[model samples]
Target: MILAADLADDRGWKGPNSATPEVVELSELLNRAKIYPLHDRPENFRSPSSVSRKIGNLIGSHPSAPRNALRTSAGEVPIVNRFVDDRTPMKRQAADIRVRIRRGLL
Candidate 1:
């Protein structure tokens, strides 16, 4: 989620239907890491479209979000707010997650 937020922050928000290459890459990373909310459903992992929607959610929750920003779930607001307040920690955490994924530890 943090990574998606960072991508949205850096490259501007792309609507859910048109995922950027970065979003697609993030989706791949997420699938490779096997970090699904439902652990039992390995087949139902993150797809590019899902990652794009998550990015949209993060953008929608941001203070500077555009008028047409997608509606985010209540649970996402706090996390989005934390990313808005201090992206450094989130970026560091994202880097850590990438490293762990690469090391096959995630």
Candidate 2:
């Protein structure tokens, strides 16, 4: 998981199952670009994994799941899941982020 603070510090992050570091970095940059404009103050953000399950539910419900995923057997894939393990593809981790308006466990 990559923390917002780490990206702010230019420390960057790479997932264990990430196929390419550049892709992860690019995604981080994109997310940061969107987030920084809305909440410039670091103090305004929540701590990692401190968000409500409702928000988590939203993330889990949205997004197309990984290709060839078992979840895709239903013809679609979920983007995130609070109950998924690290091995679960596309499972969002709570510690990886600390957005201003939302947070959640995984």
The whole-model lDDT of each prediction reads 0.75, 0.30
Q: lDDT by residue for model 2 over 1-106, one digit each (tens)? A: 2332122113222122222353354343334444555456354233223222222323233333233322222211222222232323222332234342233221
Per-residue alpha-carbon lDDT of candidate 1 for residues 5-102, written as tens digits (9 for 90 to 100): 77776765445443568778887888777454456655646788888888888878887777677888887777778777887898788788889987
Instruction: Write down the TM-score for model 2.
Output: 0.20
Candidate 2 least-lDDT 10 residues: 8-17
Best by lDDT: 1
Name the lDDT of candidate 1. 0.75
Scored by lDDT, model 2 comes in at: 0.30
Model 2: runs farther than 4 Å from truth? 1-39, 48-50, 53-56, 59-78, 81-87, 91-106
Off by over 4 Å in 1: 12-19, 36-39, 42-44, 66-68
